[model samples]
Target: MSVLVEVCIDSIESLPIAEKAGAGRIELCSSLATGGLTASAGYMKQAARISGIPVYGIIRPREGDFLYNSDDVEIMLADIHTAKQAGLNGVVIGALKADGRIDETVVADMVKAASGMGMTFHRAIDHCSAPFDALEFLMSHGVERVLTSGLAKRADEGIGTLKEMVAFTQGRLSIMPGAGVSPDNAKRIIEQTGVTEIHLSGKTVRNSLMSYRNEKATMGSGDSDFAITVTNPETIAQTIAAIRA
Candidate 1:
């Protein structure tokens, strides 16, 4: 079977790029620099309208730890509703307790909210204390897939654990290795881990169009670097080809 490639994109512009590059699906989000918070309703709706491939809306309410409070849970539930209404194909969600385990109750609620859409447990699984146990929990709860980097900072570094996770699951659930996935290593990671799906940002820096430079002010933290990172179609195509080969 051909490996599935899912590109993580933060804007509507990248949607068509990913689709054209042969990505089987997209994990739509905002602020990918901060590990991808939830995308706005407007952005989600636009992506749904234009994307040729399936778009799974990321349900993260904010950046930082996956451990969330009641308010955050409520916000995530609302986001799932918005995604469904916007005609998205699915939703990616993650939540954990203070003790480093799956927050079953909250996850159940999120799953229920996504009744008619595909449900993915996001990479927050990397933050859990027991990944194998968590995999069983998610599978039992009816989650369709889990995006994980094998509890390591980068997927290449975590190939050992990823292989183990894939073996343990045995096709009960889909295990997608993500984080730092590049064209050079995409094939190796898949060959070694036995995962049929991979996730990547496929991003490159593009300089701003403004001729007049403003060095004094900045929209985000640090200096006003006129260049912004956006998904590169060539990179996505290369990664997909690597996996296909």
Candidate 2:
């Protein structure tokens, strides 16, 4: 069996680059610096129009915890509808309750809203209190795949739990290991966890092309405003090669 590589890209420019690099799927989003928020409608449409591979738009509305209110559910549902209309192949979504359990109601609504499209429960599963139980819930709700780090900070460090998840699923759905995955560790993660699918963002910094700079004013927090985070096709290619090798 072949391993599936899903590259998480924050911009449309990276879509073709990842596809050309042999990524099996694309998880499109914005503000990946802050763990990825929802992509703009225009960005989603542009990505869907040009990408050759499957594109799954992130449906998150904000950067904080996965626990959401009613308004957040409405926003996520609207985003799911937007993704479906934008020609995206699927949506990446997850929501939890205040006590760290899967929010059944909100997730059900999201699954229903994304009726015809593929659905992937994002890394939010790492935050769940009962991961195995949560996996059962997601599987029962018709979630086609799950992007998790085995309830740890990084996939490599969570190999034991990841192994258990793959075994528990029994091939019912995809158990993809994501978070802190790199070319150096990609092959090891697959070999140890028995997960056929993996997720990564081979991200690198790109300097902006502006001759003039207004250092006195800043648009957002963090380093120079001239730097932008973009996907590195070479890194993606290298990671794919490592897994296949």
For residues 1-245, write the lDDT of model 2, one tens digit per residue. 69999999998878898899989999998988889999999999999999888999999999989999889989999999999999999999999998899898899999999999999999889999877888898889889888998888999999999999999988887899999999999999999988999999999888888989987777889768888788898999999889878
Which residue segments of model 1 deviate by more than 4 Å? none
C-alpha TM-score for every candidate = 0.97, 0.98
Candidate 2: TM-score?
Answer: 0.98
Deviation in Å, model 1, residue 38 alpha carbon: 0.3
Candidate 1, 1-245: lDDT as tens digits: 68999999997888888898889999999999999989999999999999888999999998899999999999999999999999999999988999889888999899899998999999889999877878898898788899989899999999999999999889989999999999999999999999999999989778788899978888898466797778999999998877777
User: Which regions of candidate 2 deviate over 4 angstroms?
Assistant: none
> Which residue pairs collide, candidate 1?
none
Pick by TM-score: which candidate is best? 2
